[model samples]
Target chain A: MERKSSDRKARAPSGAAVQKIELTEALYRALFFEWAEHGFSALSLERVAARAGAGKAAIYRRWPGKLQFADEAVNALGLKMAAFGDKGSLEADIRAFHRRLRIVFRHPVVRKILPDIYAEAARSDEMKAISDRVAQTRRDEAKKVIDRAISRGELPEAIDRDIALDFLPSSIYWRMVVIKSSLSEAQLRLHAQGTTAALKSLW
Target chain B: MERKSSDRKARAPSGAAVQKIELTEALYRALFFEWAEHGFSALSLERVAARAGAGKAAIYRRWPGKLQFADEAVNALGLKMAAFGDKGSLEADIRAFHRRLRIVFRHPVVRKILPDIYAEAARSDEMKAISDRVAQTRRDEAKKVIDRAISRGELPEAIDRDIALDFLPSSIYWRMVVIKSSLSEAQLRLHAQGTTAALKSLW
Candidate 1:
């Protein structure tokens, strides 16, 4: 059965198909949950099929193997972090980006899976390439923010773009993901300001 | 056999113990390598035993179960990041700490396992508590640095101590562990300086 049928069935008034869980989404959710629990090397396809209430053939029909499943699953997440709108100033831009990240990390599955994903990327070149492509896109987005600030005369050209990019996400990630702590809205703003100020002061 | 004897035997002239590979050390190595390949969720004790040239009972003898074994293995690594010597300047202290971190992330297994450990910490309370305690010690160490900077007249009392602590390791970690990228010595120094400047610019 085509995966898109699950989406189409959701809109239809069909009796049995309406009750069936969206096969594709259920499988994707199961994939993340299993990855969070068992990890990639030990992930069990039998269990994933069971968890999703689908047969093994159903999964193989969607993807040939685990790595292919992983690639597709991650791409579907569409991490697309490059869409931060022009917030007018570096601090505002940083704060907006931080808010976006905070939302992503708030997802229980995402938080559990993100670090492992990075670890896996470091170990497997295929995963590494996927992760690197995503990261480069985000960094390219960051470079835009830097360019805007420089053009606006809020930041000098001498400010270290590489270091500035690093500063934007590092503190927030350290606080939320690594330390598993939450900060107040005020605290978040102060940090955004701090990053802007820090970035402004250097090359 | 006591784990310490492995340490003792490392210095001994015995043919078997010396040439046979130290059981405890070998097990630790095997643990990291296995974690790197399989991840914690899929980690197999049998494979770890086989790789270490020991039996599962040997692992069971040291620690009761997977979580307990994880606790001991991580502790044996002794993160102890709080011991940065007085470098007479915040910038210098940051540079020194960055160097130490650079060394840790340079290890191949560590580069692979460190992110997973952090990911695991975010999921399990037991692991979270361990990572939290480790983080707290490092923060306390960072506090001492800020205190020194204040005393040395390099920083003001109003500087954002929480954000500064977050700043210390986040950038280097983002580069090495998260992005799986390396920075040159000059780039490392620039980021350290940027962090110091950023921290100094805020309260």
Candidate 2:
């Protein structure tokens, strides 16, 4: 019964609509899950193609290989977080950033895929180049907030902006890597509180 | 000529002296280098046997498996770091800890195996138990220094000790995971400075 209904709808959709629906569906399936069953190493061409219901040739045609697929996955993470700052209160901006980070950390794709990509990149020179780009993208995203604070004179002009930017994200990653603890909503709030207090002192 | 000379010495040595030499050689090999090479994975019967020049049976006689081997490795790290928390100043004590950590981070075992273990533990429930214990031990080591400060009354009773302790190690691990950078001597000094300032503010 389910197969009959699916086939009927699949045939009823126009070609462009079907293509759009399939693309959307494939991307959603690819990015939506815990990915715990098979972490990064399992994200081979075969597995991605099978999961996305696209041919291996189709996937390869778009992304050269695993590294490119991983890059696309990272680009997808940009969807999970929102830009913050310009709230006129540094504390509020930091709090929003932390809250958004908490949501991103809880995201299955980010949590499972990110560390694996990091580990793989550490080992493989090829992957490391792509991963470096991913890191820069994230840093630029972060700099937007920190730069806004500096323009508002909430931060010191002499402050090493690169080093200062390292604070919050470093704390979050440390908990993930060393402590192996999930970032709890309350813990994220505590970190935001501590970071806000520390940043205020920096000025 | 070198091999022949060593062969003559091997023949001339008495049984008791040969035993002493064997034990000494084993102990010498067990130091920082061995641990640095294999990491926790190297603790497997086959790898440890190959790396340490012992039979798998002999390794099994000593340690049941990798976890037991890891426990011994961790104990050595504790003993090596035991002489910390001195120099009669809070800044000095924190600086000392970072210096020791710098040495540890440079170890090959720490570089190769630690990230793999962290990644594995994040995905595996079984490994999580061991990983958690290792984390707690490191935290305990950090807390001991904090406890000493409290007794000295240098740190105020009102300080949130856990938050206070989080800064230095978190900063270092952050560099490793996110920045993909090694901790340089200058970076360690900067961490010490930041931590010292943070602790002082709490008082």
Per-model TM-score (chain A alone):
0.84, 0.69
How does model 2 score by TM-score?
A: 0.69
Task: Kindly report which residue stretches of model 2 are placed more than 4 angstroms away from their true locations once superposed.
Answer: A1-35, A42-62, A77-80, A182-189, A196-203, B1-83, B87-89, B154-158, B199-203
Interface RMSD of each: 1.6, 4.3
Q: What is the DockQ of each candidate?
A: 0.61, 0.21
Q: Please, what is the whole-model Cα lDDT of each candidate in the order they appear?
A: 0.76, 0.58
lDDT of 2 at B164: 68
Please write out the lDDT profile of model 1 over residues A1-203, one tens digit for every residue.
24554665666855653334378678888898898786666678889989999898778867778877777777777765647778988778878877877777777776667777787787788877767765665677778878888998888878767777888788887888777777788788877877787787675
TM-score of chain B of each: 0.84, 0.60
Predicted candidate 2 versus true structure: per-residue lDDT over A93-145, tens digit per residue: 77677666666666655665566556566566766776676666457666776
Model 1 lDDT, residue A176, Cα: 83
